[model samples]
Target: MKLAIVGGGSTYTPELIDGFARHRSALPLEELVLVDPDPRRLELVGGMARRMLAHAGHPVTLTTTSDVRAGVDGADAVLLQLRVGGQDARSADETWPHEAHCIGQETTGPGGLAKALRTVPVALSIADVVREHARPGAWIVDFTNPVGIVTRALLEAGHRAVGLCNVAIGFQRRFAAALGVPADDVLLGHVGLNHLTWERSAVVGGVDQLPGLLSERLGELAEEVELPAPLLAQLAAVPSYYLRYYYAHDEVLAEQLAAPTRADAVRAIERELLDLYADPRTVTKPEALERRGGAFYSEAAVELLVQMSSSAGSPLDSPAGRPRVVNLRNDGALPFLPDDHVVEVPAVFHDGRFVARDVEEVPVEAQGLVAAVAAYERLALEAAVHGGRERVLSAMRSHPLVLQHERAEKLTDLLLAENARFLPWAR
Candidate 1:
């Protein structure tokens, strides 16, 4: 199959390629295209893929290009891994709002809004390419930040797209390990937007296993909470950050971590992980390029696709020939969402069609939280398009953080100042 990776010059390229290597036989990839604006990065990733394949005695026709049309033309699947501003751009998004509003947001909130504004146009531009060049029924896998907003835009623009993030999938493994069960034996189910999902239920040996254990570990988990969100949500296997207001307002997290603030607990965990990654013997370098002789590689979606297609474990019975997938457009893909929310969920592929499983709807409370943030997202998009400060302020008011209209206005003022570079078109 002809597979294309846009933004192939990403830092995570090697890891993604390695993931693909694990299922190389299943994929039997004949052509791999790496497309990026930056020549150096494109060569780096494309070269890496070539070398890895050569070493493994796989004769794959790997190509690199800056032309989006050339890269995506006739492709079976296109994996979008774009970062419009790169690290410097992301810094502007994060630091601008934090500096202006004194709110440290890396992902969601004002920081995310600034990022969405800069990124949405670029994402749309790529979508335009898909419309022009991609073969019929080609899948577009989006692995970008502000996933919900981006996927929503793609759907609205009448394109086929799915937002993807490994956080939930990774957490599933962690939770399973914590419960002393094999990951495969754990029947994990999650529902919600990216980075924000409620772990619905988990089963071990066909028996419910999470509730009893989580009830006991609640106190300890609260003491050293690494993931963001509220303790109650944590108990229910939900992203802790969903209850961000409680953490800041009710001091629920503080009381839960009476000995140390939740922030403090996070610091300790960060330090430990950093220390491990920083260890001299850890070889933190990207050795795949050196040992394998290339600059870039494939990613998780590619590797997983191969496995599912090959029936290595259990043949994906879905129509698309992929084992697990994340999709946005509701053609009965997800039954629970409002038919508009871009949800990430497990999917199966078969008969050249990606089929979304029956995903349960998020709880009413979580839906309200998602709606609150979604309202801000809508306002942000409107503000960006219209350049209206009042509209931006109104959008900020949609967030729970801006409890009052006055605070929301003040927050908008701060955002305007901080995001000036990004808001030349906005008023």
Candidate 2:
């Protein structure tokens, strides 16, 4: 199989390469292509990837190119992990929101909407190139930010696509460790849109262990997710760390006001990672990469590709005891949201397609927030595809975190001014 990674110059690429090398049996590849515009980064990251593949004795032919059309041609699957304006734009996304008293996060609130506006057109254009060149039935696995919005844009444009995020698998692995079992043995009731989700249950050996865990380790789990323990006990579900933007907005804003932006931290980490990648002796994935975040992304990406890109005659089944989490169309997965809305939930590959596993239950308390965010996501997507200042304001206004019209209006202006270089519409 030939697999291509768009934005392959990212410092995150080595982690993915390491996963592919380590899990060759699950999704063996004959060719691996790295597509990116930054020649310097492509060289550094590509060298590290080739070294890791060689160390694993994997015979995959690694190719790096700036030509999207040439790089993706004949590929079996394309993974999108690009950042449109890099961390500078992300820093702006994280910084401008505070002026309006909103949380400064790249994938939530006004900042998330800003990212969507800057990212969507580029992603769709890349998908167009992939559609024209990649093998028929090739899957586009989006690891892009504002994943639910980006994945929805791809699917709505009629691409065979699914959005992948590490949050669910991250929770699964953590829960498994807590339970003293293999990661594959833990299944989480992970549901909601990407970056806006809750862990309703963690099942092991056919039993839901969430109640016991919440009873015994509520504080630990709550601390990990950054929400209050009492809140977790009240909801009886663990919310993703992103939820801290909503459930505890004031505290997060206060911290953001005082602390350096996450984008700043990532920029420093990327520099360190590139330095390591440039070293000829650095044949192994470096430890510094761990602090770069996206924990467990490579495993999640590998498992998704194995199932989604399986040949018709040998479709892979869901892992032994774990359910995959993906961003897919709601399609009645949650009756309250439109069928076209994208959702992140536990899913299984079935009958030549990925199907979201039935949610035996959803946290009732989360419905209003989910539905509101779903509404904002739709407008956000529309603004992304068709540019207009009013449309941008509408999306900002719709977000749960920026509901007040005056604040939304102010944020829209800040977003456009900060991202003018990336957004043709804003320019």
Index of the highest-lDDT prediction: 2
lDDT of 2: 0.90
lDDT of 1 by residue, 1-427 (tens): 8888888766455456565565576677778888889886665556656655565566778888999999999987788888775655555444444333434343566666666766777788898888788888676778776777777777778787767766545545666777887665555566666556666666676676657656766554444334433555444754444344334533532343334333344345433433433343433234423332112224346545563344424445433333353645455444444566566666655444445664556666667665666567667666654566777777777765555776666667766665666666653
| lDDT of each candidate versus the true structure | 0.61, 0.90
1-427: candidate 2 lDDT, tens digit per residue: 9999999999999999889988999887899999999999999999999988988899999999999999999988999998998999999889999999999999999999989998999999999999999998788999999999999999999998999999989999999989899888887899998998999888888899999999999999999988999999999999999999999999999999999999999999999999999998999999999999999989999988777655334434534313589999998999899999999988777665777785645588889999999999999999999989999999999999988999988998898889888887677
List candidate 2 stretches off by more than 4 Å.
311-322
TM-score against native, each model:
0.76, 0.97
Give the winner by TM-score.
2
Candidate 1 Cα RMSD after full superposition onto the native fold (Å)? 6.6
The TM-score that candidate 2 achieves is 0.97
